[model samples]
Target: MRGTGKADVFVMLAHPVGHAKSPGIFNEIFEQKGLDSLMVPLSCRPEDFDTFWAGITAAENIRGVIISVPYKVPVYHKCAAAHDRAARVQSANSVRRQADGTWYADNFDGVGFIDGLKAGGHRIAGRRILQVGAGGAGASLTYC
Candidate 1:
């Protein structure tokens, strides 16, 4: 159950059974931080969220969850609360469990995208961006 002791975070990717790069990306970060956390890819469908989340959340030491495509909107509806960014975007890519056992949803894709662009020396303060996508990932970039 969750490898061993506790997981500082749990990642859920909604891709309907496909290869994902998130695991490698997040696992590397977790390793660097020396945190007792792991991001796993759950091969889930759009309808298995309730049961899946119930089982995972019931596990000990799972501090948070990462919601991906197809599951984002559903999880958004189930979240206890959402950050201002998620609230405005009506979507979420991350979920954190609060001290009071409440779930908080937040979206980081927009900021990450902006940061990625800025990292490449792109001035985005007042720049026009033509993003491509209408799904969850697209919604994540809505703000920018």
Candidate 2:
């Protein structure tokens, strides 16, 4: 289900998403900046995305959506065009369905991870990080 702009930002939280720290971080930023946006998590089951998005599309206040897990792969097919990397990887961690009914998908995990590592004071520019699995989640990192 989607919430209208009675609030500021709307975040779609997928299954097994209790581990997300975005709400805390974003909310804190919103509060600090005195912004009206409050990020609320949308608890959606895997099968309910299409049905949920139907109403979300009809709603007027949702700025965007943050996808996770199973939804990422599915959203790729649903979107009109995905970012180059997301197209190559066949997955997406974020999506935006525009007013003209065009969906754009992009993967931000790789950059986020690298940035986080660097911000944590780790030197990986000329280093190697071993990843045991080079499967779905490793698609973006394999080349990094």
In candidate 2, clashing pairs total 0
Could you give candidate 2's per-residue lDDT for residues 42-102 as a string of tens digits? 7677778788767666765565677776677776777777877788887777777677856
lDDT by residue for model 1 (47-117), tens? 67688777766765667777776777777776789988788777888888888776798988888887898
Candidate 1 error regions (>4 Å): 1-3, 7-9, 125-127
Candidate number achieving the greatest lDDT relative to the actual structure: 1
RMSD of each: 2.7, 3.6
Candidate 2 regions off by >4 Å? 1-6, 120-128, 134-136
Clashing pairs in 2: none
